[model samples]
Structures are given as structure tokens and as C-alpha cells.
Target: MGVGEQLVTYVTQNGYYIWEEFYRHFLMAAYGVLFASIVAIPIGILISRYGRLSKWVLSFGSIIQTIPALGFMALLMVTLGLGTTTVITTLFFYSLLPIIQNTYVGMKSVDQTVIEAAHASGMTRFQLLRKVELPLAVSVIMAGIRTALVVGIGIVAIGTFVGAGGLGAIIVRGTNATDGTAIILAGAVPTALMAIIADLIMGMIERRLNPANKASAASQ
Candidate 1:
């Protein structure tokens, strides 16, 4: 059979397996971003409160971001060993910079006049952050999260190296085969599709959350 036929046949036969791997791949990416958000968001907020700390904290995250993906994963493997844990841990580190940076920027972006007004109304610092700053900054924060997630999906594909099964495993299998272009495509195609779909979904959410977009919609 031709390469196209071979690809079709493979996909047709292994649809269930591919679906399972796709689901697994997505979850691994999602978990990494989610965990990063929980920690990074708080740190972002704290750093925003203490301006002096922002430089050191963000620089540290930037240093982590500079590490090569595979090298970072390999370093983690020394302690984490193999499996989803190592992959997820690597992804979590990878996700930190964008999230924390965006959160800081978002918090900083809030209008000082608004803050002063809130304070005049007797709102506590905590109350101001919770009620005013956060709502205003949520879209920017989501943009960071969206970036992290899209990037994580690509990184998670590398997790197969550490025995964290995902579509990358299939691609690896293709590499082993004598004429595995079809098999490679079977894996690569799905991964690309997953990334595209994820980006689109996250982009929609970002746009919806944007204050300008809301105002435009209301005006319309």
C-alpha cells in the first residue's frame, strides 16, 4: 500500500489506542499548567505587592526558563525517575515564567486612581485585590495561562522519553520501523491537531475575558 493508505489503515485499526494517548497527552499538559498556576499566581501577587522582590523572583523564573527542555527533563529524572511525575514536574517549571510574569504585569496594570478610590471607600488591601484588581487583571492572567498550556502540549510530547506515554510514543515507534513515515504521521498529525485545537480554545477564552472585548460587545 502507499504511504497514505498505510496511514489510513493504521489509524483505522488503532483509533482507540490513539484516542487514549491523546487524552493522556492533554491531561499531562493541563495538570502541569494547572499546578504552576496555583503556585505562580500567588507568588505573582506577592511580588506585585513587594516591588523589590519582583526582580529577584522573576529573574529566578527566567533562569529556569532558560534551561533546555530535554536537559531540564533529564535533570529532573535524576530525582523524579521516569513516568508522568517527571514529565509533569518539568512542564510545571516550564510554565512558571509566563504565568508569574503576566500576573505581575496584570496587577501592575490596574489603574492607580481606581485603587485610590477603592481605598477611600474603606476597602482593605486584600479586599481591593480580590474585588477590583483581580477582576481587571484576570484576562491578562488567562493569556499567560493560555500560553503556558499551548507550550506545555509540545513539551509533554517529549515525555515519552521518560516512559510517560503520549502520542510521542507512537512517533518513537515509527522511528524504529523500517518505513515508518506513515506511522510517524499518524502520531504527529494528532499532536499538531491537539495543539491547534487547544490554542483556538484558549484564544477564545482570552478574547472573551478581555475588558475591551466586553465593552465592544456591550456597545454593539
Candidate 2:
């Protein structure tokens, strides 16, 4: 078939395949983000509360961030074998640095006076975190999530190498077929779209969650 005809056929035949690919990776990415957030947020809060550990945790997470994605994936594949479990695990680890760093930074960046006021108001530690600190830190935390989502979407293509099917499968097929253009467009297009959509959605969540935004809107 001609290239145009081929493109049309591929899209029509594999639209669901593309969506499935996107969804699988997207879900995996979400899991990774959630895992990272769960691990990071509490640690971040602890560091913020203690002040002394902030530097150490931030430094440690930064070190993790320096480990390349492919390197980590390779190591996991060697130890865990190729599959969804391995891919998800790899993505989760890759996600940690940003989430932890951002959560720590976000919580630390919360205004001292706000925290002091919360304490003066008889807010317990949990109450202060839930009411004052977390709400204030949401934006920065969201920023980290955004970064992880985008990075995860792209990195998920690597899962193809480890037998975790996704859009990466298309790229892999195109590669084996020696179709450079197919590989490029097939992999690049959907991943970019997914990342863009994910970021926009997270941004909306961040805006909605931001107390300052809500207060301003209330005033307006």
C-alpha cells in the first residue's frame, strides 16, 4: 500500500491498539506517580517538620534522579525478568526522585508564619499538615507529578524492550521493519499527546486545589 493508504489503514485498524497502548502506559505511569507521592510526601513532611533531615533527603533523591532510566530498566530486567511487573517497578523507582524532591521543597517552602499560626490555633501536627501545609504545598507537589507523568510517558516506551507491550510495540515493530519514519511517528506522536494531556489535567487539578486560587476566586 502507498504510505498515505498505509497510514490510514494503520490508524483505522489499530486505533484501539493505540488507545490500549496509551492506557496501559498511562495507568502504569499513574501507579508510579502514586507510589512516588506516597513515599515522598510523608518523608517530605517529616523533613519539613524536622528541618535537619531536609538536606539529606533532598540530596539522596537528587542522586537517584541522576541514574539514567535505561540503566535502571536494564538492571531491573536482569533481576526481575521482562514483564509488566518489571516495567512498573522500574517506572516507580524512576519516579521517586522528582516526587520526593518536590514534596520536600514544597513543604519546606510553606510559610513559617502560616505554620506558626496553625500551631497557635491549636492545630495538631496532623491538622497543621492537612489544613495549612498540604494545601499550600499542593502546587509544588503537582509540579513534581507533572514532571513524573511526562517522564514516565516517554520512558514507558522502553518497556517494549522488556516485553511490556504499549505504543512502544509499534516503534519496535517499525524498527525491526527498518521503517524509520514509522518508528518515529508511531512512538513520538501518541506519547507527546499523552504527556501534554496529562500535564494539562494535572495543572487543572493543581489550580483547583490551590487555596490561594480559591480565595482569590471567592473574592472576585
Query: What are the lDDT figures for the candidates, one per model?
Result: 0.94, 0.80
Residue-wise C-alpha lDDT for candidate 1, range 1-220, written one tens digit per residue: 8999999999999999999999999999999999999999999999999999999999999999889888999999999999999999999999999999999999999999999999999999899999999988989999999999999999999999999999999999999999999989989999999989998999999899888898899999
Candidate 1 vs. true structure, TM-score:
0.96
Runs in model 2 deviating more than 4 A are 1-4
Instruction: For model 2, give the 10-residue run with minimal summed lDDT.
Output: 178-187
- For model 2, the local distance difference test gives 0.80
Q: Looking at candidate 1, what is the lDDT of residue 117?
A: 99
Residue-pair clashes per candidate: 0, 0
Per residue, candidate 2 scores C-alpha lDDT tens digits across 56-127 of 887877776788777878788888998777778877777777877778788888989988988998999889
TM-score of each: 0.96, 0.91
Model 2 pairs whose backbones collide: none
